[model samples]
Target: MTTLPDSFLSLPIAHRGYHDAGSGIIENTRAAFRAAIEAGYGIELDVQLSADGHAMVFHDYEMSRLTGETGPIRTRNRDALTRIILKNTDETIPALPEILSLIAGRVPLLIEAKDQDGAMGPDIGPLEQSVADALKDYAGPVAVMSFNPHSVIRLAALAPNVPRGLVTCHFPAEHWQLLNEKTRTRLRAIPDYMRAGASFISHRHDDLANPRISELRAAGASIICWTVRSFEAEIEARKLADNITFEGYRAAVGTG
Candidate 1:
């Protein structure tokens, strides 16, 4: 394993490629991915198992939000999924393997998988073997991430050497004092994240700078921020995060 950076953890990261709002080049699409790769940016995209256990690139819980469909994406096979028109364009969701093959070694891909929660229609259940199986032959830098800690555990077990990142953010639900107390306990156990063989962490830049990242870094973990677009935030985060993922690929100081 190569050593990464503490400042790299806080760098400017793009939010799923630099697609303008309401533009056809939306996040997780092949066009957006290509743009990111061409721009030399570290790209972040989502992956979910299809009906046939093949990984498909997507970020939403359903296609309705992007494609205006009422059904789920996992229910359809590659052909069917490919046929489902995406927005105004004829392009459909691309398979994960295909995306990797296309990108080759041009850039690194950050894959965020769905949780075991079966609520968002049907897809492959949370299984380490399943995720590992799909990524077995993938060359170049690959990192798996999910909000579900259990999924992180399973992925670590299946692929001991593969880097896993735990994605988390504070939701507006609990009281400050209560949330702080609960967060402390959660933070303590997070060192166990290293036990999960996690090489990096994909979290909000604010979270990385909140002392938690330093704690995790002490455990020999790479801290990476998600969706850092602001210039000020980028500068501040560069002091904390090890690798910065951006959409436009404006190379600054440091590398992953």
Candidate 2:
């Protein structure tokens, strides 16, 4: 039962490392991370496993969106993946270790392990283990989370000392077509909060008023929400969330 530190909750987090694609700072790349660190905001990024099992800091499972290449991210080894320059930038995809070394505890990090198991089921591993291995020796104010509870459960076993959380959201059927109705219904309620050994939850910002969120807060879980794009939205989210993960605009530091 590791606790989330105050630093993690004190400042607004930059969703995907303060990315601004128009400025050549792509999401989850070194440039974006550097921007976040320079801006004095906490960072929240996603990680996926490369073919050889190295942890890569990226959001998409496929390369087509972020890179010129076309294939699943796991199809490429770390070295090859690192060479595929991000679209519109000279920067290549960064490995977890590279970003960790760059940040070096300068600000709190909230890392989300992308669900390799497309159905958000139990077929998880290599990625969580790689993340654990990366963090084993690093000293930082950091936490790991995922939309998949099984991934968080795995993190508890692999890196028990680091704080763990769940990325929660309303499972709107149209948006979550891959998840069956039963699965969506079960997850929408967030029943795994206790079972996953989560210290906090980074829920969807617009869904903050969901009663389950209130229930979790009542049970003492630190409430955080994601993708707050405007200061007005931040003000609204803060009413229910202990902190916010934001992007697209500058979030005032130490003000919430």
Q: Please provide, for model 2 over 68-106, each residue's C-alpha lDDT reduced to its tens digit, 9 standing for 90 to 100.
A: 999899999999988998888898988999999999999
Instruction: Give the residue spans of candidate 2 off by over 4 A.
Output: none
TM-score of 1: 0.79
- Per-residue alpha-carbon lDDT of model 1 for 172-244, expressed as tens digits? 3342233445544554345446544566677666666566668777877777776666656677767777766
Residue 77 in model 1: lDDT: 72
lDDT of each: 0.63, 0.93
Per-prediction TM-score: 0.79, 0.98
**Any residue pairs clashing in model 2, and if so which?**
none
- Candidate 1, residue 207: Cα displacement in angstroms equals 2.7
